[model samples]
Target: MKNLILTTAALALGAGMAMADTVRMGTEGAYPPYNFINDAGEIDGFEREVGDELCKRAQLECEWVKNDWDSIIPNLVSGNYDTIIAGMSITAERDEVIDFTQDYYPPTASAYVATSADADVTGGVVAAQTATIQAGHVAESGATLVEFATPEETIAAVRNGEADAVLADRDYLVPLVEESNGELVFVGDPVPLGGGVGMGLRESDAELRGKFDAAITSMKEDGTLNEMLKKWFGEDTATYAPDGSVVTN
Candidate 1:
């Protein structure tokens, strides 16, 4: 299923490769609230709102292209997309390959969710999205890591007993746990990972990166970034104030 999605995205991107003047924003339109395909089959969510504003402020003509998460970075390097505005975290390893704009979202916690409260998240099989920090963490934590191509598959793995638990961003898991009622529950302490979420760009596109960085800085100064974060992640989350201070609950 994941392969099919990637193949379709590749074919669609091949149909009309990016022109010289237009910027193509690449995202994994599968993660909700951060990014997702709405009922209308269009990309919609917090990153969508933030990306649109950044483009407007940077005065760039931009278009959004959905890609599977696993190949998001490679496709960007291949020129299938101009910028990756996905909920990608800024990390040293990733920095070795692509330049990143200043973070639009602050560092958040990764959490464990399981069908049983007694599930040993630390010692048993844990599921995470492939190529994500959570997966990397699980791999090094002495736990058996089972990687899935999508967030939904990780949850499914837990439900089907294929994995003991699923580790993912806390904000993304909260709603799912609530909706699951007594079926699923958060099972361990939240683990902090990554620096923050930033936009990925080609190293040669320093000008483009600077434009987005400036736009993000402007939004931070005006408090618009915090407002959008609150709207999507909720008011209780840690937010950046216009005075450059972080306020947390």
Candidate 2:
């Protein structure tokens, strides 16, 4: 009986260790209300929230790492981290590089921006993620837009008037300007670019992609996802918030 008991304990320990699923994620700790570094030196924001949720749903452990925007894709491809969930959008160009899980949130659904001038550089190169909707807008426009290493850089450019305007997910910037002293305003409605944040998995690790997508879909089904959204964007802040819509307390 003693030998049998020892074997059972060993097996249990092994199973426990095996079941301890861990996923490493990367994000830019700059985009406030999304993902940013706090005074406590801890990472927090909307994107982080989504990452946490997916981990819980998938019953996996999650470890977050601070990453520079310019190097995020390269690092993910290099296997530095298990995945990236830093408000990363789904794009054709990126799709060519890596596999992705189903979207956890709408891409530009709640993301919009404003500037000193309503010049409408929606298709111009002003301010946007390199391969995101904002960049697409800049590309469509004839203006020269700038790409920065992170969202904080873009927001700073807008705040200082160094750039014409900063374009990102509207939900992110709306709260920013409202919290600011008074130097920013919306240019138009929330531009629907038809995308959202998703986990970027390695092209070879298709198995993990299925795991993440299943987790994301489960969150969508349960009310946990909705509750999380409300906590971030208020009861009505995130849902149905169109472009140019004023969302302030």
The whole-model lDDT of each prediction reads 0.84, 0.63
lDDT tens digits, residues 132-164, model 2?
456556656676788665567777776666667
Candidate 2 Cα deviation (angstroms), residue 110: 8.0
Residue 116, model 2, lDDT: 58
Candidate 1 wrongly placed segments (more than 4 Å): 1-19, 243-245
State the displacement of the C-alpha of residue 51, model 2, in Å, after optimal TM-score superposition: 2.2
Name the 10 consecutive residues with the lowest summed lDDT in model 1.
Answer: 1-10
- TM-score for candidate 1: 0.91
lDDT (tens digit, per residue) of candidate 1 on 6-42: 2122212222232458899999999888999999999
On the 0 to 100 scale, the lDDT of residue 42 in model 1 is: 96
